[model samples]
Target: MIRKLKSGQYRIYSRKVDPKTNKRKNLGTFDTLEAAKRHEQEIQYFKHKG
Candidate 1:
């Protein structure tokens, strides 16, 4: 998922919340939504490859 921060930056997070922490994992923070989405796709590709 992608979220916009108070600073106007975009953040990428895992689709599911962590069972232990009860929070979504912070994948990355980006200056733009497009950048965050691109990183999210890379993460998905690697995750599925293994």
Candidate 2:
């Protein structure tokens, strides 16, 4: 998921909460929402690639 921070940047987080931490994993922080979305797609691609 993507969230807009108070600083106005976009933060990319894992959709699922970490069982150990009980919090969403911090995927990355990006200057733009598009960038965050792109990175999320890349993560999905890598996760699914065999």
Clashing pairs in 2: none
Prediction 1 TM-score vs. true:
0.91
Superposing all C-alpha atoms, what RMSD in Å does each candidate have to the true structure?
A: 0.8, 0.7
TM-scores, in order shown? 0.91, 0.92
Q: Which ranges in model 1 have alpha carbons more than 4 Å from their true place?
A: none
Q: Give the TM-score of candidate 2.
A: 0.92
- Candidate 2 lDDT, tens digit per residue, 1-50? 99999999999889999999999999899999899899989999999999
* Candidate 1 lDDT by residue in tens digits, 1-50: 99999999999888999999999999899999999989989998999995
lDDT for every model? 0.93, 0.94
Give the candidate number with the greatest TM-score. Answer: 2
